[model samples]
Target: MSVPLILTLLAGAATFIGAFLGVLGQKPSNRVLAFSLGFAAGIMLLISLMEMLPAALDTEGMSPVLGYGMFIIGLLGYFGLDRLLPHAHPQDLVQKRQQPLPGSIKRTAILLTLGISLHNFPEGIATFVTASSNLELGFGIALAVALHNIPEGLAVAGPVYAATGSKRTAIFLGRYLRHGGNFWRRAGVADFGQPGFANRYGGYHGSSRRYYGGALRR
Candidate 1:
């Protein structure tokens, strides 16, 4: 396989790590979830300020005004869309499930999934294109992007799992699978009863750690 494709796959695969955290045998305790959120949030904020933004400013021929303006636009745009979306909380989903959610709520989840998939599709393209253009930069970008995307797996899988109670669908949506047998076996969660590639990992993309973090809000 080509270098770009390889990098893309490796980066894409990190979601499984987050998914495992979110959807393993049991939901993490609230304290653990809170800690994960805090850590993830710290990573995101520090990386954005120290690495991502600086990298943008350093981009050849890019003016500070344009770069900062674009950054602000992204910030506003994310919040604007966040408000527009009818995202359900993983915690609240339990109560919502006991009482049948309006069709609109289900529709909201569907819409969120579609919009997120569309938005995240570009990540693969970005990784592929950048790797093709510059090897070192591509590796750096891929690593940064992949590290950030780990929470994306949690964001996607947790809400859906809470909403639907269907692990299979979550796995299907998360879209990466390789190994999980040993963990499951040790946890006594399941017995796959097979060998290599026996268990599946699930996750989603685009929403980021905020969703996972916010889901824990009391």
Candidate 2:
């Protein structure tokens, strides 16, 4: 399949998976959910530094100063636009249940999903365009975009699940997936199956130790 087609398929699959997870009536543990969000954050941070920024710097004989300027401008543009709009938080209800009546939950879910979809549209275009221009650049963009998207899935799923308590319905509306045997197997069953898996084997403990040790040493 073509690159755009592949990306579309992958995005669709992700949405479907998110939906399924929402519908499965399975509540992912707080730790697991937290880890997933952390993973997504790490991935986005890495991609921003390693891929997107560098790509912007290297575009077609552009001076380092000009490239960097453009990069800053792009960042500001995003920031400005974000500021102009009403902030949509997918996990708003999930984290803080101070407002939002039960009757309004579904409406909120729909609005949240719509917001996410609109936000991702430009990202999809950017990924497609970059991949079309350079394979490595495309890979980097895809990785970064995928990382950014994961948390969004959690955002959509968490609130819907919280409000409705119906996994299938949530999945249908939000397009998230529940963890199943097949899903776990695909994601590495042994890793997930192990107790304290993220802490023991996924860098959490080591990173924490280093961070705390540095803080104490300082």
Candidate 3:
């Protein structure tokens, strides 16, 4: 019904697109995956520097000094997160037999799923709160969020599907169900814009349970 809710759903649903791609017989080339990831990163950087920073600087009572400090802190935080998270590349997940992964692919999939799920929860809250404050701003944030989410989904599904060779199981466990975590987290924040964390614990946890349990095995 609300604009923010609609944007959240559409953006969250974009994961299905990536999941669809990953479930196909052939994975995308390294060049294409690299390009997509590059575009997503650029979208996020531009949104932060061009849109979010300027908007923050313009807010009433926000000092230039404080605004610049906040921008610096944000940059520091982004770089910090970039260093910490070991994001997967879809190119690394193909069924190529020439060279193989060093570790357990299933374990890699699970760990990546955990990392992505945890990272996405806060992002869900951020997108909801930002959009609720400014409708137009919310759309941009959602788009940026969705842009990155697609690659993330493809990264997860491509490997798991290659290993498991089960489309239903891979789609359910890898991308589709993982994406539900984003939706419910964002939905909780949107529903309780004032205080967000309380309901989200229950909601995202439920989604995770369903995700793990519902990945119908072939």
- Write candidate 2's Cα lDDT for 66-166 as tens digits: 55554555456555545653334333436324555486766676666665554454445444444544556556545645544555565666677677666
Ten contiguous residues with the weakest lDDT in model 1: 201-210
Ranking by TM-score: 3, 2, 1
State the displacement of the C-alpha of residue 18, model 3, in Å, after optimal TM-score superposition: 1.3
User: Each candidate: RMSD to true structure?
Assistant: 12.9, 14.4, 9.4
In model 2, which range of ten residues has the least summed lDDT? 209-218
lDDT of 1 at 17: 67
lDDT of each: 0.48, 0.48, 0.60
Which digits, one per residue and each the tens of the lDDT, describe model 3 over residues 152-214?
Answer: 778777777766677886688655445665656665665655334424442332222112111
Task: Name the regions of candidate 3 deviating beyond 4 angstroms.
Answer: 96-103, 175-177, 187-192, 195-218
Q: Please name the candidate that would achieve the greatest TM-score relative to the true structure.
A: 3
Model 3 — which ten-residue stretch has the worst lDDT? Answer: 209-218
- The residue pairs in collision within model 3 are none
Model 2: how far residue 107 lies from native, Å = 2.3
lDDT of 3 at 105: 83
User: What's model 1's lDDT at 147?
Assistant: 65
